[model samples]
Target: MKHVLKNALLLFGALFALALAGCGSSVTDKSQKTASLAAASAEFPNADLLVSADSVQKSLNATDLLIIDARAASAYATGHLPGAINLQHSAFWAKGRGLKDTDTVAAQLGAAGITRQQKIVIYDNTTASWGAAGRLFWMLEYLGCTDVHILDGGWDKWSADGRPTQRAAVTRAAATFTPSVQGSLKATSARIAGRLYDNDFAVIDTRTDEEYLGWQLYGETRGGHIPRSVNLPYAWYYNTDKSTLRYQQLKTMLESRGITPDKEVTAYCTAGIRSGYAYFLLRLMGYQKCSNYDASIWDWADNTSYPMDQAPNYADAVYPAWVKALIDYHKPGSTSAAPPQYSYDRNHKYLIFETQWGSFDDMAHGWADNSYLLGHIPGAIHSNSDVYENGNPRWFLLPDAGLKTALGSMGITPDTTVVVYSDSNIFAARLWWILKYAGVTDVRFMNGGIQGWQAAGYPTETTINTPVATTYAGATKPALLASTTYVESVYNQPTAKMVDVRSGSEYSGMISGYGYVVNKGRIPGATWAYNADDSAGIYVDADATLRSYEEVKSLWSNLGIDFSKETIFYCGSGYRSALAYLYAHLMGYTNIRNYSDGWEGWSTNYVEDPAYLATPAVPGSTDGWRQDPSGRPVATGGL
Candidate 1:
């Protein structure tokens, strides 16, 4: 067997040569051709059954050599290596089946001047249609061709390296090709069915997740894969750029999926095309006992007697025990621990509000709007919070009259029982703080926000609601809202703690928040109290619920923050900071205030006044940063 690491290096070297071949202008001049020949010879060598472009170029005048382009007819007609005959890969396919009949395939090859005695070289575009050359090579080998070889990097390397090309078609005199099929190299449906229960056999489905899981029916009588088959998409073998195979990565991926050399592997896909690539890779990697199920799932599914199975989709695949535990913990009603008294459930008889920040259409890219449009608690009305302030000059809270007018239009009254939620819990928290600052009592935060409600199987709607406009008697409350001056005063105070609840990236002077803040650094002397989980957006559990009270409390306690001091929280535009304020209040902190303008406020003020910028900006440090008790960052980067 080939050493795994050695094969990986070889693959990388071949890919590097192909990448270099595509640079600069084509090799047209004699000097360029001479140089390219020398470079190609040094970079690429003829492996067992793999030929280099230079070798093929050097042998173009040999009468015994026949070069075949295995790409589409259109591609071949565009430009092809000189004297190369077009034998498009599709011509080798069995009519209405995955594999061609041995006699028919032999005749087709003979018509294309492919004789058993002739030395054959095959190629296809390396990047676009993967494995075409490999498939042809496999078929030719199975037919017992004596001298067949595949171009190392196929047409891509040949054309990219500035080899000679011709647009005119090349016709070859018909030659005889004898049928000498190697039955052991191909698996039939009946053979695969009989080996299904054999411990030594492994059936690999080399299709996409959608096909393997039956999520899509692609030209099959039914969806899903052959029974007892494992899915290993062929694309996984290639690098992200699709330039070449990453052999070590491919080996690790296959091994993880239980596709090892120990088993008698039979690979298949929607058709045999992709599986042919798998067959080539397996053989090249020295997996001695492997075959291609040429008929694949297409023929297998057409027969009613053949059994098929739809494996679990990607999301439903098995996860580790710890992941399962976390998932279970976040499910609604799974935890018996009480949520904050101020957090409300879906059943609460209050006016629910969804405080999203963008236009309805912007929701597709911006997580906030998309979540609302996809599904929101049935009675919740959308609130575009951006319209509540003059954001350009500065994000200033609306005056009492403007606030009252907006609330009245939204059907909110002084006695209204308000329940707020947002996809980004921070948005909802900000709105809650805004309502409280406007002196609206009886306000409550949804414990886990809209995601929590959805996870609990609550009904959701996409329809927009038109509220019955009512007069809201606005009463401004000054204590809940902290001004910029107040935030500055508490920044380094011993009895008062200012918390920068933005992302580490935002606090570290690495990036400015939302491009509105002129400076990158945080307010000097403020502790980094943002839960690591909030880094992605807002901190939420596996099921999108807020973390448990104990979990959240521990986050602050580890940062040396407690209820003993007057706590003030701030984030970009005050949204996330408002969430921190809400959490602190729920954790029983006596005096909590939200710097509503947040980093945006402070930074904008500093930008407007050079003196504020000169006032010695705080240097950011992770010293007091909040982390999970286990020392892991709480915020995962994905949903």
Candidate 2:
């Protein structure tokens, strides 16, 4: 009875205070908002942490409904959610400032009209710019705000759906904020330094793999992350449309990375902003024991004694929607739009080719299947190897006139930008070399190929686009290809490296990798850089997508090849080496060439040194192999 009386008196006192203030039109109170979001609350244990933009739209009339725009003041000045006050989220924490005192934070938040009891919504471009709203929500939670929530999908989602926005600046009556600061929410650098090797503790670096792998990004005192940190990245949790993925699939994805409710997880980025966003995600995912390493790498890396490790590599890719955005983006109805671009000049046209051997059916699904010839990117034409090269027994580029006819028939020109991909990374690479050799100015080879496209959960089309044929000027880049004479000249030179991108067994002279190539011996001085050996699984990810820069560099370095030397790459034929050459070229190595003659020309037609062959050839070795130049290991693992 005493407790009930005290509550009644408090309620009466609140109403009395409101009566003294003339306008009490703001805020519909907490009960009304909860009733509106009952569905989300029912769907997940912590769904109330987020509120839909629809709810915010409905509540726009409430003057006391504090909506904070967690973006730059410039962005807020342009346009923001109705009545939202601009507050840059990154200002919450800083390198030199660190996490501020509760009194200081509360005073600032109160000036922004945020109180402990008011209904508040914070929003930002959540999927872009490291999800600023999430960090704001984290800060609010730490300050003991029980009625705060983030606007789901934030500004981008609301604006994209044509929701209400305003340009007028808002200044609300300042409300008193009392901070019940939660220190556990923020993990100091000292805390993480001690827990680096603890199995039960998981440290997630919420930065790109490039930054984690020793790049000195964001003014870090040193390169690389704290030792034993796993890079989950901030963008991985978002969809192509820039919304955070919710529910079971998201749970599974997180669990796969060993991030679970059971572990005391700590997330960090260059500073605290990205990591604060990460903390919000963890809490939303129902993980109770999570914290943000606010100082993160900036401070930790500066300490010389702190342990650090650099990673070898990661996958190279672009988001599927980024590609689709290029495909679909059109400006003002008055403005002229250009085609999908790979060039600085957006007006330049480009072609997507489904590079493959033999027939169109081989590249697509069988004619009888219900897939409707699926398995290729939309608007891709089947670029058959048969038409472009001398096939059946040998695979090599045709003469210039034949090449011109083959290329021109496919609508290729010196000016056209070409994109090629294949189920076999080698085939795509081979076509890439062919186009580059024929003097096509720009050609892009999708390193991940079809598997990469599929793995990204994007849709593909089987539309066999007909090329609008263009006449090609017959031209060649002789420097890209190695002639027999050129190969012999560089064969044993210390100034150049002959990289054999073949399988170990083939390099060891066990058997010729192809039926057409009868020779089993390798070039005497060729370095065994591993190849497309399916069984060996060399030079690629488990899914056969391209390896990253460091991985590729390491592979070559291990085989006596380096960017410093002029590299001449070869395989049983030229196809496999072309793939390796493509990777090197993309990595900015210009002094590289693919020898089309490969081992076929070397073993069958090269004038071998009589003394070198006269001695018994060493077994299972590159240079000392006996009679019959067998393919060592080309095409074992793909590019």
Candidate 3:
């Protein structure tokens, strides 16, 4: 009986322990449920201004909820959150200028089924670095949308979290949208210009360094930024992954750049697309007195009278004493016996050589056609290249006596600093080389030729001017010219680098444009260094300017051609190669030579000798050679 009683007690104790554990678990589950509910309903600091993804998801079915996809139509068409209406951000702005008309913007928003009464939640692809959502957010506020909010992390977070999405378009009943234009939100050109030098105001240029530094890749009349403006590229506001804004970091960067909240900040870009993003960010960060220069640099730069800070000067406003000294030294009548180096300054006698060779238009061929009457540089003399050539084929540099006569006719003395320019620069280089070879002490190729000069906003003239002819005596400088024999002797040497500056097709033996050269191939032991920006030729920039000095240096360095080696540049008929020779000289290369006759002369020797064509076209092989009985024999050495 005692044993039975003990068993009952043990069984009751076990039941009691189990019951306690179950009660504890029930309490813990209730606590977890409360915590989850709290997390799901977590609110942003300004819930009226911004909303979290979870909040937006929960309110998706609400009658007053108006989900807006602010991305482009193409992106919105792919796949968007369920029931989101597509309204592209760009629609808020004018076609090419400032903001659109208030009535038009309002009517468009109404057509998109946006009503002021609805609770608006805006979003974009959220994967791009651009502030599309922010831009729309600002636009809505400008239109006086009472309950507008931007979706945090936007569609990226929503889709990534396994939320429902639909490809089908969503439409809503048309509703009236009343716009309340905020005059203070916009900074006009006059207003921004007035505040440019104001200490209390800060003008921010939100563009790439290339644009800010006035490279003008976007086809501006002039290449420059607004005077007294600081650059803060819009991309800096977002994280590298573009997942979300780096709010605190951006605030710090702004403060460091003196773009403080205390100052009246105005931001601008090419056409205010980027500045609109900056405006939204400043507003979001509690900057009260911020305005967007909606007209932007496009409008500002278009107005020629407005001041612009040009490159190299804007960045380095103060020049050192040594730099100033160098500038003075290069000026005319400096009393320095040294010859003038390559300069873009208009301190020398300008000569325009308009050649019509190759793809150039026939109507504009040479100076004799009076092409200079169209538009020539101010105070420039037009000289014809056709008149300066000798030999049956034509366009060859004239003999010493003929060159002297031609130079004298153009009033170009031996000591005159002639700055030569042309449309293609190929002919200009030929003229420059010819002048240099003929012992003209100071001849410089215009850094970017006539195209660059015109782009720089320099003066142009239509009226022609004639200068009195002068006596010119010149002596040929043999060191600058590379003969066929001279090229062959050092071509295979380790210290020499022969750069074939022809097109890729010509260098690869694909198509020899010349009729005389029956067979096609590069010179033996020559490296193909085509002067091309892409697959095209070197003249690629909008203004046909030479690529930056660094870019040209990198191109040569990539091909293992450095200052240490003797570089030989050549091309078809030596025209394009002459430009390369001038480039090498400007780059301060010590041992650079131009094969003046180029492939025209080189292949002539091969065509004259049947023995050369009998053997296979093998690069760097002695079998590719033959004697030219015409006295210009194929170079013979390492063979």
Candidate 4:
């Protein structure tokens, strides 16, 4: 049996190598398409597959080969190859599993019966399912596991050819796997901070070209990418599988676009999550000096001091032909109908205000508008968009205690019936989410914003004096928030509605950034509603005069959305989507939730089964594509 397996492996290797190499033209380029043991042996020898079913079948004997299965337990329970050990990916990366901790992973391998002497073979459903398999492969190599190989097409490929299978599970005694850290693969924020100006390092802002061009805003901060940073969107690496890249092809493609292996590269996205994936790819491709900027674009944009550069030609440049094609693909026709059941809930009533005191710039403008020493809202208290106590620049979530203090300092209290507004609807919605998370209810945003108020001839004081300091004390309770976990569970369930207010390409993953890969589709059940358009020049809906209920329902339903269910809205950082939330509130939806972290949050902290929305996939008709006065299409950059 051992001889049969060894001979088959050798034969398969020779045939595959010959087929992939072809006649003359370089073996490296074409071999990228087919699985090659030669390529594996050369770049990632320690990460190569050690055995296959062919070896077992052809040799009629097997010894010294470890077969590992990477799949969900449910999938594994159904049927897996004989002698294959199940190693689910999600389980290893549980909440407490520190991905950066190499020691823990080494110990895990040791427990999995991995050893230096034995050969290892790993397989999964496919390349996409290979996420766990790939991570495991990387980890094993890091732990000095040589003579290891990944099943080319994974289990699906094996089964496609009618390979042998067994139902019974077999357990083996654990083999010790120890890792000694060797490379500079992981990078921290503090480390990058010191190297910000180091010319030897080139930072790759792995966000959308639009974001790098300052076309869209992140959180409540302005839009623009880190200065001197090149845009090599992380999504460019993967094919339809979204798990493995054609390494040789990608290496060449990236090099042609100026990402060389010799240069020190640092990658970042909205938060560190997407960039982490990019960081992993760089290391896999033999790039020794690559690390992902975990804090990502969000952290960089948070601080005004961080240097930024906007691509000069983005606004005026003609749209890529593909984008124009996308736009023309789904132009909304007059036949589009309004939602079936859409109307505002008359039970809710509150005076929503639009203020400009959420940020230092907004605060300055707020002071200019109402020269009062006191902060904001007439009967309301102060609420900055960046209220997180830990000081994460993107104004990310904060603990209930910190939120309570921030609210208390601003005179917020339970039963306040608060009205929040800002220059950006996200800040208002973020505040609303935080308040709700902290257990304060009855919140509303000025629909038309401060502009609506001033336009409506509402009150404003220039020489405003300080008001009496009021105490705000609210308790933390379950009713107040949709915790991250709660949000995740609700999101995955078929019952919840996820609304993405970002532009069409962004929602579709055609454009990367704000923490997601391009062409990868959206959250499983998310609906896209571009942005808030009102008399206030495209501000997210804030005042009571939102789009008519008929209009809101029609807009979403035309996009194939079911309006009668529970809904959760989000955008880059919960701003524009707040307008959708306001619209839902106005439309009278009883169960409304907002993923405050929104796309930024979801893309960073959670991974969902990819589900494509059935709505129009057109560009301009959707969002992300811009039309000029002459009707020429253009790439608007960020939305």
**TM-scores, in order shown?**
0.47, 0.54, 0.44, 0.36
Candidate 1 per-residue lDDT, tens place, 1-639, comes to 469989999999988766645542132332322211222222212224555566667666666678889888899999998779988767778633766677888888888877777678877785466567767877886788767766667777677666777899998988889978887888889889899988888888877544664534356776777766776666554543333454565576567556788989888886687788778767656677888887777788888898876532222211122122332344566753222222334333346787877757567656345666777766678887865665443556776788788888888887666767777766777788788888777776665566556544556788876678888886888788788778766667788887887777777767765643445567766778664334363355433444434345666788888667788888777777777776666545658888887766666432334454355343431122111111211121211
Q: Which ten-residue region of model 1 has the weakest summed lDDT?
A: 625-634
Candidate scoring better on lDDT of 1 and 4: 1
Say what the RMSD of model 4 is.
24.3
- The root-mean-square deviation over C-alpha atoms between each candidate and the true structure, in angstroms, is 18.5, 12.8, 21.4, 24.3
Model 4 spans > 4 angstroms off: 1-62, 90-97, 100-104, 116-118, 125-127, 146-148, 159-162, 165-167, 196-199, 202-248, 266-284, 291-639
In model 2, which range of ten residues has the least summed lDDT?
312-321
Per-residue lDDT of 170 in model 3: 95
Candidate 1 differs from the real structure by a C-alpha RMSD in angstroms, to one decimal, of 18.5
Winner on TM-score (2 vs 3) = 2
What residue pairs clash in candidate 3, if any at all? Answer: none
| Segments of candidate 1 deviating more than 4 angstroms | 1-47, 240-243, 311-639
Query: 1-639, model 2: which lDDT tens digit per residue?
Result: 999999999999998867644332233342443324322333545787767666677677665577889888888899988778888866556673456777888888888777888777888886555767777777888888877777777788777876667799988778799988887887877888787778789888887645765556467877777766766667666665555677675687568657878989998888777887788778878898899877788888878888876542211222233344444433224243332333344555677787766565643454222222556777778787888876645566787789988999999998886777777778878888899999998776665567766765777886657899889995889889997678877777888888888877788778778765555657777778877543355655445555444456656776657768788999877888887887777556789999986877676532256675566354332222332433332232222
TM-score of 4: 0.36
Q: Work out candidate 2's RMSD over C-alphas.
A: 12.8
Question: Model 3 residue 66 lDDT?
Answer: 80
Could you tell which candidate, 1 or 2, scores higher by TM-score?
2
